[model samples]
Target: MAKTLKSWLQILLKLVNSTIGIVGISMIIYSMWMARVWQRHMEGSSDDFFSFSVIWFILTFLGIGITLCAISSFGHIAAHTANTHCLSCYMVAIFLLLLVETTLMADIILNSDWEEDFPEDPTGRFDDFKDFVKSNFNTCQWIGLFMFLAQGCSIVSATFLRTLEKRQARYCESDEDDIAPSLPFLYHPVEPLPCTVADLPGAPSSLYWC
Candidate 1:
């Protein structure tokens, strides 16, 4: 029963990670499309600064997509194997991710001068980022909050699965202990059957024939 539950939990973990990965792919695709559209719109432009800024933002978004994709990949591995090390590393990575995300969100919500907190990019992309965030503040915040919750849920589920793994290991060890005492008896050597040419004075053949 415990093993069955663990299998189901692994399935759930894979599903959630796959969903997150799909979202990352979508983000990557959208960012690429936006970059293409912007490039086409500015085909004949000579504004280097603006072009650079747009490119920088596009790359930033692309990086986020890649990061998420990577996290999802790690999650898939951890789920499939249920290895202790993998699970522990995944939990740490996810926790750190959550911590950073929470911090950024808190800064956004609580700090009016959050823009000042972000370092200025050489290509002025930070200004564009600020504009974009301000324009889509509500949607961005909600999405961030959603991801925060989802990531937390993933960690919690993974932790539960880890505990289950430990329990399963312990159960196996106990079973081995119970079986160990009987192993010698179970595998004891058998007496040799009488040889065809060996006949003894006893009822059954027990010695070489004269």
Candidate 2:
């Protein structure tokens, strides 16, 4: 039988969900490394140019990434098992990530100047905004963009993918009914015996049982 739309969507969402987890975990690791580097540099620096709060912020962001990984794991489980409750939790996590990513993207687009932030060289050759992002944006920003897209797609697909618990229960019942062994009739009608020559008359007296 052909697969249902929900099954296809579940597959797609599971792939995206796994990608998000991997990317999120990588980002967390990168952030932690950066934080450690900054800490080591700050220890010997005479000038307080960079605050320790940056490390805290990085750690906080890493925490968010860890949370994303957890949510993605749950989503995978939900997709595999068709668990409605787990799917709901996964949706909630995707929505929250969507909110955060959207907010960050908006902040970057609204407050930051692409041209000024990435000024031209001495030859006055400047990269376009697209190229500027490719050359200048940090790993977190890039990963966040990817995460945003993945989560958005996942959320949309999940709406169609999440199976209804009641419907699933009914489907299970139907499958059991199909597989269950049916009992044959226990009370078959008794067939009447044929009349023989011996049963017809007194000749049957010796042959017939009392």
Candidate 2 global TM-score: 0.60
Clash count list over all predictions: 0, 0
Global lDDT of each candidate: 0.80, 0.68
lDDT of 2 by residue, 1-210 (tens): 224756777789889888888976886886677566556766766745244343444555578778878888888898887677777888887888777767766776797664464333321112232475577669647765776788888887676666444466788899888766543444556687765434556564545432
Q: In TM-score terms, which candidate is top?
A: 1
Q: Which segments of model 1 are wrong by more than 4 Å?
A: 41-54, 119-139, 190-210
Which lDDT tens digits does candidate 1 get at residues 82-177? 997898998898888778877887897799988776445554445666799899989987877777777887898799999999988998999999
The stretch of ten residues in a row with the least summed lDDT in candidate 1 is: 117-126
lDDT of 2: 0.68
